[model samples]
Target chain A: MNRRPVFLITMLCFGFAFFYIPILSMIVYSFNESRLATVWGGFSTKWYVSLFSNRQVIAALILSLKIALISATVATILGTMAGIALARFRKFRGRVLFSGLVTAPLIMPEVITGISSLMFFILLADWIGWPGQRGFTTVTLAHITFSMVFVTTVVQSRMVQADQAIEEAAMDLGSRPWQVLFDVTLPVIFPAIMSGWLLAFTISLDDVVITAFTTGPGATTLPLLIWSKVKLGVTPDVNALATLMVLVVGLGVVLAGILMSRADRRRDADARLAYQANE
Target chain B: MSKAYKTGWFDRKGWSDIIIGLPYVWLVALFLLPFLIVVAMSVATKTPTAPPFSFGGDYPLLNWEGYERVFSDGLYLRAFLTSVVNAAAAMLLCLIVGYPMALGLVRVAPAWRNILLMLVILPFWTSFLLRVYAWMGLMGKNSWFNKLLTDWWNFVVPVDWAVNSIPMMHTNFAVVLVMVYTYLPFMILPLYASLERLDTTLDEAALDLGSRPHQVFFDITLPQSVPGIIAGGMLVFIPAAGELVIPTLVGNSASPMIGRVISDEFNQARDWPMASAVAVALLVLMVVPTMLYSHFQAKSGGAK
Candidate 1:
């Protein structure tokens, strides 16, 4: 047990390298002076300049952000509801069905989900005469449906791990259910909710296949735009865009990591303080 | 307590109802109901119009043609084969690459584990499209990575067989490669979660009783992680089997995967019934493993 399995360490490092190399290459090639993604003429920021100026990409990016924002917010609210219900209620009518629905999306192929939802939307339009076109509304709806799965999973785990005694005690102290919820339950699972929102946002932003199926020609998301561009072949402009996205996502993740660690340490201090005060 | 708060509409029963009922209705309407609709559309006939499958043509309107085509068509069958093969290869490769890494994270000093786990998850946060696109750049003809591989191929293979850059783009090889890369983190995270919970006492006892480390690993660790493996495998396999992006971007067009076939049928051919049929078939194909995965998940008691 004491022996450092050198093989496993090498495998770990190797796996990380495999993950990072393609990302690093994309970043490097984004600065390429040549129009070619792979071939380096000299280091230049011309591609970034063009990428920022590109109206289509800009439009797509803005639309994606808008969808992500809306989807994440709605999914978080709904997912938090579902998570609490699952974690606390223990059993209810159609509980089995509800759990199945939530977890199915987590594993279901996007193509099937995408196609089925598209047909479902079409049927809705034909029958109800609403959502007449598969545009922003349809795409946003599709995103919310799937992205909520991540949110539910995240919040569910957190809710399960959360100490329910506090809520019980709050009720005993004459806190109404809503008061206990808002004051105690919500605060305890706040970080999970935040991360869940973030996950939903990213999932919505990054989706392509489902978005493709549900989106109209008018509603091209960032991933869709990226897909169309990359399908032709790798271009330096796309590389630049990819690099910028990678940096943004990477920074967001690092910031989140730091915040979480700080929060964790603060939690430890709070636990100790609570113990001392109790004594 | 406040009088106004006490008389609020959200009573205890009301609160519970809202919490459970809202998401429940949303899911049934969007998720479960759509699948049933897909099943209905699968057997309908394709007509030439907006919402192409018509209800006015025949009273019963149960055109088994789409079903027949799905059952009998070589293209559909071949596509299924390609998807399964490529996805299976990717799933196996991910487990191979990720298992050791997961074990290492658990084995390493406690201080480094979270950081390493974060590294595994960081890529997952970035745009999946961009991640696949990164591989495209690496695999392109003039790319240094491809050129390096080309040189290696040239060195190893017979002189006549070696000429130019390796065709890493637009092949099943590329599809599987990218799928493995895309899904490696999914494999690792679940494996890590399961492995981290494993008791070391059993391993210590086995080793102290004269069993070798590898023996202890095979006899104790591997058997216990069956649920993890199934979870991870299902996670990787199901999605990879139905992956649309990688196949479209990098796969050989002549040999389309199941996902690409369904997309093309719907988008290009505009055969709604056929697309629905294919989608139904794909869903049916996925049912066995999906059920197994859910069963394992329920037993594992992770999340509902």
Candidate 2:
């Protein structure tokens, strides 16, 4: 059918190569015996061993995971509510301002966000004694503030596309507004919510600049550690750590792909069965 | 009209009000308040006290001295220029590399499209710092990547002009390269969204009217995808300009970007007012362009 254009294929090939080559090289070099990242020596797992032994790296990884988990969960909850208000509620006081807040984080420079939030925390500490210091708690709050914008957009789109009749029907059947939201709307939008959570989690985990501003001493994240270490030079231990992260992310993506395709196939089968019955 | 359904007490409007009010409060406190504080800090005087900045002492409350320094200092001005140049270059490169791939994804068969799109986004899921570090490894002088580039350069040019290595690291070139790599997905996704929704029937009609493929694309596809182009460009450009990680990691330390300057002023020099001034200036630079872009976007949207 001449659908496969030569120019398009070439572009795709080059683009994907440019994207994957650096990461693939890092993974390959992680196994290299040589201390130098580029020089190929015999494969070894010593870097992996060293990465495990480094207590700072391990502590940073744990801290990052904890922050990602807590921030993503809280952001998802807040974002979903905001999404519903924008999508379901026709009119509210200051609706324009609400929408602006949701999208501002998407475009605002990370530096501005980082600096502004740091100031906010310090001001809060001076005014009140709660969160007496800026550390993990402060970083988590900052991440949630920004990452929730992404979550809101995701959930808002899903909610906008969702059928309203189901929720209306539930409400018609004597269900409370909260019940309609919980039983009908939430279930329908659960997939979007889950993906929103994942998006927030990854963003929080990978964040460097914002975390740099918000985090205090003894609360270093993985990216912060890697940044400081790479300033010294790329070590084999960091390469090993990157490889493990790639492995984990790769598995998660492939699993999601498989699940999506299975769902699609099931939907196709259902449609075909209905068509056959009608015939 | 008869009221068919009863509104339960629990389902009343108050529930919705409370639900929405909570997030609004959180945003006002966390997001808006912080920015306001920055604005205040920008106007404050630098002091030797604990917080390092004070609103008023012997000096006037609205101190324009930090902003005066930002405007007069050549170093800060140069940093601003470098940031604009570097970010613009990265944005242009991303557009060039991303446009074709996005077009390809839209044109390809459905079976392979999803997989390819996944590939485009999969790298994004990995840590950005690690990805930049990988470039550092590649661009370093004794690496195979640099050697390969050096060999290619030597092959193309006369032997005398060629050197041992191209010296890729610690330069604006490396910064832009890593930026394009990191932000290519941001450019591609919006572009694909707009490109995929394009009416192919318009292209078919143009072809039937004796237009060539290139002519049809320029006339129909390119004009229609302008929205996507703007969206992608802003997404890449804004972040690339504000970007601290890639520049500090790969860029030459001789001429720091504005983001670096802000960090240095805040952390190293302990100049909160000056850093806040720079931050405020950077925000102004970004916001003006953004407002113009959205204005154009709305104008074009309204025309359609």
Mind giving the per-residue lDDT tens digits that candidate 2 earns over A1-279?
144378889999999999989988899999999987778889999999999999999899999999999999999999988997888776678999999888888878888898888877877777786678779999999999999989999999998999887776777777766787778888999999999999999999999989999999889999999889988887888899999999999999999899988998998999999999999
Residue pairs in steric clash, candidate 2?
Answer: none
- Per-residue lDDT tens digits of candidate 1, residues B146-252? 99999998999999999788888899999999999999998998898889899999998998899987888899998777777877888898899889999999899
Clashing pairs in 1: none
Location of the lowest summed lDDT over 10 successive residues in candidate 2 chain B: B1-10
lDDT of each: 0.88, 0.88
At residue A21, give the lDDT of candidate 1. Answer: 100
For candidate 2, write residues B174-224 as lDDT tens digits. Answer: 999999999999999999999999999999898889988888888999988
At residue A55, what lDDT does model 1 achieve?
A: 97
lDDT tens per residue, model 1, A1-279: 545479899999899999999999999988999876688899999999998889999999999999999999999999999998888886579999999999889877898899888989988998999887888999988888998878999999998998777777677687877788899999999989998998899899999988988999788999999888888988999988988888888888889789888988999999999999999
Candidate 2 CA-lDDT value:
0.88
Scanning candidate 2 chain A in windows of ten residues, the lowest lDDT window is A1-10
